[model samples]
Each structure stands twice: as C-alpha cells, then as structure tokens.
Target: MTPRPGRADGCPAAAGQVPGPQAGDAPYARLDTEEFTATPHAVFEALRAEAAAVPVVVRGGIHAWLITRYDEARAVLADDRMAKDVRHWRDFHAGLVPFTGDVAVAARRNILSSDPPDHTRLREVLLSAFSPRRIELLRAQIARIAGDLLDRIAPRGRADLVAEFALPIPMTVICELFGVPADDRPGIRTWTEALFHGAAMERMAQASNEIDALLARVVEIRRADPGDDFTSALIVACDAGRISSEELASLLRAMLAGGNETTANLIGNAISALLQHPEALKLAVGEPRRWPQVIDEVLRWDAPIQNSLWRFATEDVEIGGRLIRRGDAVIVALSCANRDERAFAHAAAFDIARADRGHVSFGRGRHYCVGATLARLEAQIALPALFERLPDLRPAPGAALRYRQSTMSRGLISLPVQFAATPGRPAATCAS
Candidate 1:
C-alpha cells in the first residue's frame, strides 16, 4: 500500500511549530560520533528521557529525527505517512547529503530502497523464492555447515568467533542457497563488508558498483544454465516479464547482503551475550528449547542492525508531538526502542526469560526483515551446537571486546573465546 500523503492528526507542521533538525548544532545529542557507535546506550537513554522523537545527526553529517521510544518506533514504522524511497529524502534531493546505496541499483526496484507496487512485487517474488518449506529443508544443511565450521576451530584452544565461526557459516549458507560460485563469493563478501563498514560515501557506492557488476555476471550464468536455486527462480521470473533484469540483479544483491551480514552479526551478538550472562547461558544450554528465547533476547539486547535506514516523511506529519516537515528523514532506533524502559521493566537489563519478546529487532509491519526466519533458524541451530561441542567455552583472558564502528549497525568486530582443546570430530557429510 502507498504511504498516506499527509497526517490526518491536528498536529500540523504549521509555521508556529518548531522546525525539524537543522544542519548546524542541535540542542539534543548528535548520534553520528564514534563515541555513540562504541557506547550508545547512555545516549539512547538520555534521548528517550528527553522525548519520543529527537532531532539528531547521523553519518554523512545528515540531520534527521531519531525515534527512540518503543511506542514511537512502532508507530513511526507502521505510520503510512512515512515512506521508504530515498527520493523523498530532502537532503539527498537538495544535494546536501550523499545517497545511501547505488543510485543505479536503487533506480531498479529492490526491497531495501523501493516503495509501493515495486516493493510489493519484489517482496512477493522474494517470498516465493524464500518460502517456509525451502527454509525448513535447509535446516539440516545449516546445522551441518555450523558443525563443519566449529570442527575446524575446536582443535585450537582459542578461536576468533567472528572470523572462524560467526562470519563464515552464514556466508557459506547464503552462497550455497543462491548457487553462487565459490570464486565469486569472496568478492561478494568483501563488497558486502564494505557496505556495512564503509564510513565514506565513495567506498559504499564503490562496493555497490562491485556488487551489481558481480550480480550481473551471476545472473547471466544462471540464465544460460538454470538450476534449482533462488537465483534461477528469480531469473525465471525475470524471463517471464514478471520483473526487470535490473530488479533480478538488485534483488540478488539484497539477498547477498541481508542473508549474510545480518545473520553473521546476529550469531556474533548472541555468542557475546551468552558468554557475558552465564545464568542465561546455563539455562539455555541446560534446556535446549530455551535457545529460541535466549536468541530472542539477544536480538532485543543488541540488535545486529542498531538503526534502520532512513524512512522519509511523505508530507508534513507529527510523530509523538514533534512536527516533521515534508521530506525530512526519520530513523527508527531499534536498539533504543528495544531497551525502552517504558516498554520493558528494567529495560536496560538483559533477561532471557523476560516475557516481552515483541521487540522491533526485525522491525514491524510490511517492511520487517524478510530474512527474519532464516536468521532465527541459523542462530538457534548454530548456538546450541557450539556450546555442546566446545567444553568450557569462555572469552579469551584480557581480550577486550571491540565492536565495529558503524552508525547503523552494532556488532562485535571479533569475539575471542577459549575452550578445552580436543581432537576435532569429522564434519558431517550431506548430499548436494
């Protein structure tokens, strides 16, 4: 459905209303600093304490409204007045701020950047390719992939989970699912990493170019010799005039990024949480079923993606008493929303058993992450298997946990842990 052109509420962006965030210094917090990236909770707490919606600066020196409270976040996400297309971003259109993704790629319809019928069509096609039945069938393969990864690292008493475990498993699974050739995956991985970690516009745009180029090559290969894979299915849709060639390529790129980056960081975040909270870890390990709850808490506690990309105001709209001008960018701070004291009791604390599992980690409504099920499935299978396979697994002594600095993402750069050294078991074998 198309976003509503304007808010019906009496709260209008009248001249008397305070204007949205300006380019210069703001009275409230600026979220673009590295300090915020490293330790953002305090800032979030203060921002939430102040108001539901606060004007803040993000990366690229862009000024926008950050939705901090849980209720406000849900409202803003579901509110029809908020639009997803970057063309609605006032600063980007005015050339005041750099664009977020590949202009060429975004010109073609993709889930991350498109709105309306294009987004609807692309999402339906994606659902067909990533059906529940297909995800269920891949469960065994995901487990085996996790087992293979742990097997390589179990021999060493200590391992960097981010490298050996967290990152590779998801990358491998997504690549296999898409039928992406092994040789092409390295570039894909590199380009995806750049998209998440790149601080400058040039680098992110460059990565987008590289990803589109590689995806174009892959599309040509899949079209020539089709297979029973996601890419092949999408190619079929493209051939039938259901979607454009650029849409197919752009969607493949979306899968490559979302399937791996989000999942990889999620696995990393879960492990870090478990190690820090022995009580939760013990309960999860003691009872296998609780792994889901534990993973759920981790999603709330430290979401893989901290803040959602910009959702622009289709017209002047009031969000939680603040008047947002037409075209002003708004970001849903999932991290803050999850830990909102108003939403959860002792919200700052991480309690796996906490009854409220309804955090916006995967977002809400139609724009919710399409890969949520797959991410949960991967974490649930991989997490338990790791603890069961490694004895006395704990963080490396004196190894300070470092997080990659990104305004939009919150994930451990590396999770160093030690466990009892043992003779590694042979990895499980499965059919192609």
Candidate 2:
C-alpha cells in the first residue's frame, strides 16, 4: 500500500484527501488529566462523548493521538500502516533509553512492540510454549496453589485479599513455569514491583540490573541441570540455533513479566470487582460454570493492563477524522475501548450477565497476550473456589482499598475481606 501523505498540520492525511482535526482545536486539545488516573469506564465515556480521535499534547509539548471510538481504535490497532517499533519514530535514538529502561523496557519485552515479520517470528516462538493444551495441564497446579493460599488465610477471619491470595497465586505459577526456586520467589516479586513502580531512571536501572542478574543465574542453572520447564526449553532452543541468546533473554523476560504481574493483577482486580458486586459473586459461587462469563465481565469492568504500550506511526495515517503524522506515538487505551458504548451497550454497567463482554483487555491482532488462556484458567479456578469456600466474603469494615499508582497495570494494592471459615481441605485435594 502506498503511504498516505502528511498533512500541513503535521498529521497524516487520509487517502482521498480527508483532513484530520486541525492543530490547536479546542475539542482535540482538551486534556483530561483525570482520565489517566480515573476509573477506566469514566475515561471511556468522556472520550466517547467528546471527539473521536483526540489530539493529546503531553509534557515537553509532545503530541500524540488518542483513539476513543471503538471502531477507530480497533482499526488503529490492526492497521498495517501503524508501527509498534519505536525505531520507526523520528526520535528513535532519543526514545531508545526509555525503551530499554525500566518502565518502557518492561512493556517492550513482549512482541507488542515489534512490527510485522519480527512480531510474527517472536510470537510464533513463544506461542508454542503457551499453547492451550500446555496451559490446561497447569490448571490442576493452579487450583492447588489457590486452595493452599486460601487455607492459610481462611482461619485469619480477616485477610488482605491482594497480598494473601491474588498476588501469590499467579506468581507461583509463573515461577513454576520458569523453573524459579521457591525461596527466590520473594526476590523476584520485589524486583518486579520495584521495576514497575520505580519513579526515577536510576531506580529503574537498578531494578533492571537486578532482574538481569537473576535471569542470568536462572540461565546458568538451566545450562547445568535443565528440566522440563519453559526456561529449560528456551535454553534448548537457543542451543539448537533456533534463537540467539539475546532473543532468548527477551522472550524469557517477556514471559516472566507478562505472565506473572498481569495475571496477578487480573486476579486482584477480579476479586475486587466481585467484592463490590456480591450478586455477581453469588452467581459465580452457585454456578461454577458461569466462571467464564464472570471473568469476562470482570476483565471488561476492570482491566488489569490499562493502555497498550506505545505504537509509533510508520507513515501518515488518517483514523477517526484525525490525520496522524509519521513518527507520532499513539497510546491505544484498552481500558477505554472496553467501555466504549459503540461497541458495548450500557458499557459502564457491571453486569456479569451482559452478553457483550467485548474488551481489548488482552489486546488484539498479532500481539494479543500469549498467556491469556492460563490467566483465564487461574481466575476461573481461584474465584469460584474463594466464593464457594467463603460464601459471605465481603470487604472488611472501614478498610480502605488502595489501587496501585501505575499506568500499566490497574489493580488494588490491598483488599481486606471478612468471611466465615469453611471446613479446610488440603491444597492438593481441593482442585478436584
């Protein structure tokens, strides 16, 4: 396809000479600072009601486009003209540091940041390990982990759901998958948290270094005594000349971060949503089969990953009446897209029974989350088990639920809940 021409306003003019929103336009320029921090549904509604493609100017006068309309957002996400590689940007070299640094590096490790052939190759390699059959085998293990955690916290009468249950469950699973030692789980968790939440570049650098060091150790261990784990499998692939060490490291890092943190946050967010809607919890508890629907609603209501990492425009492209210029950075608001009224009726309403649970929570196209099935399985098993075991589960009185201050993952830091204890079952016995 021939590349579209750039507009006079520096936006990409659509084919057939359609003009996008002009620069300095009030509707396009209005900044919603709260959208960055507010409930995703609220942000979605605001953007839908305002304009289609809003021109958002951030710090240092950097101009990026925000697509709020569902169709437009989907088009942008799937469009071949849009580039996920930051190197395509005019500021490619300048953005390299941030891209490799903590926050961006964490986001970029996955195939989400690559374009075409590279994205296809990287995704194909990882998808082989994360196939549905492989993830299904992990289900029994996940259920046992969830049950074990519940056994520990059930007697406490009151427990922080996030810390006690949600965070540890998926972390354990990811560790097992990666062949990380049980004793080293805490360090990995701390490192991930620090890397995700680190504010300064130095802190991020330190966290990155620590993560690299840990992965190096893991690689060395697998080299000496490889096992039937993803790490070992990756090492084998590298040795067989199927992939380079750098590619192996990137894939492993991506798997660790993507599988661990996102799934944990998804569980935490789902639990919080269930706590807020007791009816939904009751339905899920009574009908375990309804877990699929319940989890979908939870994902739609409170997505774990907020905005997709950044996609730079490869060439001029017009979307939703906005002409985006070549090299422009576009942030696709997945959280916003989930609640778009055009795609979902009564979008803001948290109805688990809603037939249209369409959401971009796992993203779309070639970069969709590889571990999505595993994440869904973990949530399905954990949520029903929690509600079934503790039917009266509710947030503790006067306890304040605090969300983590992050643009990437949206989840509660702590969710204190009070519920009556049920007869205990060994973690291993509870899965069946």
lDDT of each: 0.80, 0.72
Decoy 2 TM-score against native? 0.87
- Candidate 1 worst ten-residue window by lDDT: 1-10
- Model 1 TM-score is 0.91
Stretches of candidate 1 off by over 4 Å are 1-28, 99-109, 427-432
| Model 1: per-residue Cα lDDT at residue 294 | 87
Please report the candidate that would top lDDT against the real structure.
1
- Candidate 1 CA-lDDT value: 0.80
Task: List TM-score per model, in order.
Answer: 0.91, 0.87
Candidate 2 residue-wise lDDT, 40-83, digit = tens: 55655677677667665332223457777777778777788877
lDDT by residue (1-432, candidate 1, tens digit) is 222211212233333333335423335467767788778888888888877888776654556789999999999988878888878876555545545433322333578878877888889999998889888888998988888777788888999999999999889888888888888888887887777775366776677778778888787888898887889999888888888887888788888888888899899999998898999899998988899898889899999988887788998887777777898878899999999988899888889889866899888887889899999999999999899989599999998978887778788889989999877674334232
